[model samples]
Target: MRGFGELEAAVMEHLWAFPDGATIPQVHERMQADRDIAYTTVMSTVHNLHRKGRLTRVREGRKHRYRTTASRAEHSAELMREALGSGGDPRAVLSHFVERIDPADSRRLAELLATMEEPPR
Candidate 1:
């Protein structure tokens, strides 16, 4: 899958922020408040995200409201997983990552690993 450009990431951030989803005008309006952005550019970005399976949309009257198909955390995790599996030594990659994380995150990761080892309820 092609990586997202700045505008694409911004659009996705807006959709993720608005769980109910947002129309192109809504996103464009918010973005334009910060900087000049063309409505068509936002529209095309949302359409591209939808086509890439990163977003889902539904028609509401004359407009389409878009939402992310996966939560940000899930999307990030998938990216990490893909990178780990991408012809590199997974163990080394993970070890290097773990070694670089802060102590708090390391502790949290340990806790999560412990929880995963628990039997199903």
Candidate 2:
């Protein structure tokens, strides 16, 4: 969301929520239900997302249906990775991040790490 403006974020959120892809009109309708927005605005936002490689679109009959190229979790992970890569000792960054997480999340992270360390079956 940090990398996108208001309209762009709304469009991306809608596409991610709909996974099956939606036409510009569908996205516009959803946005309209939430607040006032123009059809051309949704159309341009989706086209921009597609051009930026954040979304993919396919022509479905007379309409182009758009969907997220990456899931929300994947995008979040990428953002985290980018943050870690930004001029810091990766170990320290990870340690600080892990230290701040809640106990439940820490336990889950440990369990995931343990599972990752196991040899493949």
Candidate 3:
């Protein structure tokens, strides 16, 4: 339910870009092209992501190929839900959230809310 740190977020972004999944070395190489990061650092970050249940891995010979357990949009929604629930008043939180978004997104949110079925009491 927690958000990712800088390195973990970068690793997740890279993995999300590759739908077929990527090995630690593959991720490290991609990361290295942009910055001077160590291979072991990427390896540790990927392993931590897997341990956090944010990623799923399959044995690819000696190394594990990793992919995100949820889509980027899904992860964002989960984080929003967590944030909403963390507050004492969800209504106030949602009100603030809606107020902060752009007009187009506000309209879209209204449209989505209008289409949702009411829960049975």
Question: What are the lDDT scores of the predictions, listed in order?
Answer: 0.86, 0.88, 0.93
User: Candidate 3, after superposition: displacement of residue 121 in Å?
Assistant: 20
The 10-residue segment with the lowest total lDDT in model 1? 1-10
- Candidate 1 backbone collisions, by pair: none
- C-alpha RMSD by candidate, in order: 1.4, 1.8, 2.4
Tell me the tens digit of each residue's lDDT in model 1 across 1-121. 4356898888888888897988889999888988898888988888988888988889899888888888888888888888888848989999999999999999999999999999999
- The order by descending TM-score is 1, 3, 2
lDDT of 3 by residue, 21-72 (tens): 9999999999999899999899999999999999999998999999999999
What is the per-residue lDDT of model 2 for residues 35-121, given as tens digits with 9 covering 90 to 100?
988888889888999888998888999998888888989888888888888848999999999999999999999999999999989
Q: Once model 3 is optimally superposed onto the true structure by TM-score, how far is the C-alpha of residue 55 displaced, in angstroms?
A: 1.1
Position 91, candidate 1: lDDT: 90
